[model samples]
Target: MNRATLLTLGVTMLAPLGSAYAADDVKVVEKPIRVLAGIFSAASGANKQRTAIGVGYDFMKTAATNPTVYGVFLDYNSKKVAGVTTSLTGVGISGRFYLESANAAGKPYATLGVGSYTLKAGTSQSKIGGKLGIGYELNNGWLGELSSTMIQKIGGKDPGGVTFGIGYRF
Candidate 1:
């Protein structure tokens, strides 16, 4: 082979090795715990649309391509409806399945949870409920999500609503 051709072949063969070494030098740090605080806007169903404050804690390591996060959340809202003071509170444990790598710039996830919810309007009743949700998380530790919760029948009416939330993970 000519010197020029040999040099070209050598460079081409070495380029990938150089890139592989560079990739090995790049380390990805994983954060296993995330704390979140946000707002929840209840969807209209058995109750009027109301906004509530929510807090959550998630335990998941970002080293996996698809990580299942275990989390717990609490939400509370109080408002007057038809001249009656009403309050709703929910506490739940959830499992979130991530669609992509947690280290990805924008990751999508689906969640399922079960919990007990209490509604107080003149009287108070507690019911077992389930929730389903989808969320998008950004690389900067911010996330936006929407969920629907369905509580057991209370007074012949199912008290449940959709919730929207924005949170930060740290």
Candidate 2:
């Protein structure tokens, strides 16, 4: 074969392979804000167990490797202490640190937050609180987490304890 003809054939044969590599290099663009909803089971300082519903939003565009999330939660139980029913409400802002790349499947993360918590019974009391948690997230946007929270004493009793939750990101 002539040299010019051989070079043309080689270039034509490799054209599709070069395009495939370019396609693989394309990166996925994610939405700036991700909304989430979930349910959590919590134990209070009084040793009462209650279930709660929570909702939150995550800021996807961050300088850090992980995302920052903000959340609001409410929980109540019929169990009365000293003949009084009690309920707790709170809002928190947390940051997640991923063990691996954010887009990896089955990724694990650690979270820390500070917030304000309120307790309501016959009267209402509010205090500052902090939370620490660990979680695992699937590539499909489902996550499970376990956390511990500590709220400053209200009327000489702590209002926070351990919580387990499941959430979905949208």
Predicted model with the maximum TM-score: 1
Any runs in candidate 2 off by more than 4 Å, and if so which?
1-47, 63-84
Q: In candidate 2, what residue range of length 10 has the lowest lDDT sum?
A: 25-34
Could you tell me the lDDT of residue 116 within candidate 2? Answer: 67
Model 2 clash pairs are none
Q: Give the per-residue lDDT of model 2 (tens digit) for 1-170.
A: 23354345334433443454455532232432333334334444553666554555553223334533333333322335777766677675555667777667788988765566777767988776666779887878788877776666676666776667777666
Task: Give per-model TM-scores.
Answer: 0.70, 0.65
Roughly what TM-score does model 1 have, to 2 decimal places? 0.70
lDDT (C-alpha, whole model) for all candidates:
0.66, 0.57
